[model samples]
Target chain A: MGNLLRFEWRKLWQQKSLYICFGIGLAINFLALLSAKNFGALDSALGNMCVALNSGYTSFLGIYIALYACQDSSQQTIKNIYARGYSRSLVYWVKYAVSLGVTLATALLYWGFNFLLTCCFGGEVGSFITAVGQALALQLWVIIGYHGLFFGVAMLLNKLGGSIAINLIGVDCVFVVLSLIISLLKIDFNVMYYNLPNLLTDIVEASLMMPEFTSSMVLRGIIIPVLYVVTFVGAGWLVNRRRDV
Target chain B: MNENRQTNYVITTDNLTKVYGKKTVLDHVSMHVAQGDIYGFIGKNGAGKTTLMKLLLGMSQPTEGKIELFGSHQLNLGRAKIGALIEAPAFYQNCTAYENLQRFAILANAKGQDLHALLDFVGLGNVGKKKAGQFSLGMKQRLGIAIAMLGNPELLVLDEPINGLDPEGIKEIRDLLLRLNREQGVTILVSSHLLDELAKITTRYGIINNGRLVEETTATELMQNCQHKLQVLTDQPKQAEKIIKKMYPQVPLLVSESGVEVIAEDIDSGAINRALVLDGVNVRGLTAITDNMEDYFIQRMGGNNG
Candidate 1:
């Protein structure tokens, strides 16, 4: 098991894109903070605010990281990993570990930069620390759901471009448009399973954006995506068992 | 309770079958590979060679039948004690040869195979930092063999190992596999469309066509059972083939783009020439065909697929 992790760690690191994407992710987070630097107290207040005023920035990873992680699956390298003596479960976890490490680092950098921006704008470190810590913690569950979701998408489709189109363009964009159109009717299906991904985004947004948010909303909001991870993980396993590797 | 059920063979299958919805990909198929013999699985394209390898590798579940590997019913045994490269060399193309081997060794359970020693063994020693993606096709193929040798696997299964290799690379891989078989006593199962190469090294041949075993025999018996043809490019080759088949119906005539082979016993070029002329067919050229494995394989699986 230790050997398999070492093997996958070495394997994942060999792709220069991993580091390139890390550098890019860190840069995006840093730039998000830098963009708010000159806004004086307001920008800093937004930075100290539960989430980035530019909450949409988090979606950058939705596109970049999703495609980046799926690249190995697209190229059939993960299949090669299975050819190695490790069990399918082992392969999933090693990829999970490496991908989590990278995502955690990126999330921390995002949190750190927001904290810096908060402090720069005359906000107390306490609020920044608490809010950013809570936000980052919530991001972990989101990451888990995303990880399982993308692995299933990538494994089933076996193509990064196709998976991205299906997930981001088809699923996310379509749901966003539907939610916007339904707003006039005052019908809120956005919180329904039909718009689960949007619900994840809305949940995160609500966690950070609420004028007075509590820990319970964060926990409750995470429940659906966690369930999603379980469902997709089981689906991924079934697909893997059946896929012609 | 049944000691005879467990044989010395490292790999064996009984009537394996695979079906996809409406299509039967692999029909009832059965074959055995012994502990030490270099078994060659020969078949044409889409003959379900890769499917069979995948089934034994536990990458795919068979729709019917069972496969035993390394003296056990563990479908995943092919994952351990056995190293395999199916279809093509699938390493992290971005990684160096050493790193690729390190992964396989880990899967095979090793840090690396005395790194420097294996580099020299596969003749990739001088390539200090060349990533597998940057290496030429031949270099990648050699690295693949080195990767397979990692953890000192006792059984090696290679599907179309020499698929895209150049002549030099083909010879290099041939020699490398031979060395592993001869010195290391590693049992190898190599599937290839190229029969001549397999003819030189394979101790046993398993001819597969449309997912059924047509023949399973030793290289020597293949030579003895099949007739040697004197390939003659005669104007009346059709007439000559008729006469030959009339005399020897068992030895089927093989016609290629180059010439026709009169499947008869111990017939010199002179006899073939005389027979063709007397049969009113002008003989252009006559060459005695060697009783080789390629000839045997072509004869066995050529039209059998259709």
Candidate 2:
């Protein structure tokens, strides 16, 4: 298991996409900071940057990490990976842990840099601290949700083209169409965060300005992505065990 | 009870079948590979040769069959002890050979300094830093073979391991496979379209075609089923045929335009040459043409070009 994790870590770290995402995040935060220093809007600028950076947990960065974790299977190192005596389940979880670990690490780093700018650019330290705390909590939920969604996508597509299409187009369509229906029908739902994409939208909405929590937002923000994590991961396991390489 | 459970065979499959919708890829195929034997699985394209290997490796599920490895059932065989290469070598085009091995080592649960040993085993040592992306077809093939040796698997299943290689590449892979089997006692189940290569190192073989096993025989038995024919190249082919027929009426003959091939199952070549010499036949050259794997495969396949 340790070896599997190490192996996954190496593959994830070596890919150029992770660093690219990090760079993009840094550039965006720096740009936002520069604009705030000139215009005297540091706190608001930092909040906007946090919301955008947290989207990395849900949007592009998650896809990049999950797709890379599956490089072994995609490149036919699967047989080689399995040759060493570990059960298939262990391999699956190691990949999951590695992706989530990297996603969480980078997301924290991206948001941390943005917060540091908020402090340096005339924002009060106490308010900045509270906002960072809120950002961290929302990020945990968002990454978990994205992890579930992307794990399923990676297993189902099994190719880079298909994974990219599903994550960008398929997930967006499903979320837009369902979230539209979700709003139009006025349905009384218990677990809004139970659905991954919807929960991500809520996570984004909550991270926008204040640290207040609503029951519906919390349900949609916290529970749905967790449920998706279970549903998606289970489905991915089934596909991995049964599908042809 | 524990002693009785020890497996003498490396791979054993029972009634394995794979079906894709209306097309059945494998039909109730059962195979046994003894421990420490280089078992050559010979077949043509679309002959279910690769399907069987995939089934054993758990890359794809068998529609109907059970596979066992190392005497235990296939389900129980840990991933670390079986190294296989099926079809085209799947590789990250952007990474170097060293990086590729690093990933493979992790997946195989491979331990220790076997990395260098693995590369050296397949003759890929000292080229570790080269990008796998830039490798030639033959180089990629050799690298694939090297990757298949990861974890020092006790059983190696190579599906067309030498495909798309130059003569040198083919020879290198073939020699490496033999050495691994001889030195390390690795049981190898190698599928190949190259019949002579199979005939060279394989202790046992299974000829498959059209999704069914035509025959499973030891190399000796297959050779036994073939007649020892004498191939004669002659300028005066028609006259040579008549002279040879008149000389030995009982010798089974396969006469073609270029020459007459006599399958005198157990006759001395010198005797036939002496007789032909006595008949004033201008026999250009005569040599023993033995039966090969292709002949056995075609014979069992009932290919009617005779």
Q: What is candidate 2's lDDT per residue for B21-63, written digit by digit as tens? A: 9999999887878888889997777889998887787777789
* Highest-scoring model, DockQ: 2
Candidate 2 lDDT, tens digit per residue, A118-157?
A: 7677665444445445555765776777777787778766
DockQ for the candidates, in order: 0.37, 0.48
Name the top lDDT candidate. 2
Clashes of each: 0, 13
Score chain A of model 2 by TM-score against the reference chain A: 0.81
lDDT (Cα, 0-100) at B74 in candidate 1:
62
Q: What is the TM-score of chain A in candidate 1?
A: 0.72
- Lowest summed lDDT window (length 10), candidate 2 chain A: A189-198
Off by over 4 Å in 2: A44-57, A83-87, A128-135, A179-212, B1-7, B74-79, B114-121, B126-128, B229-264, B267-289, B304-306
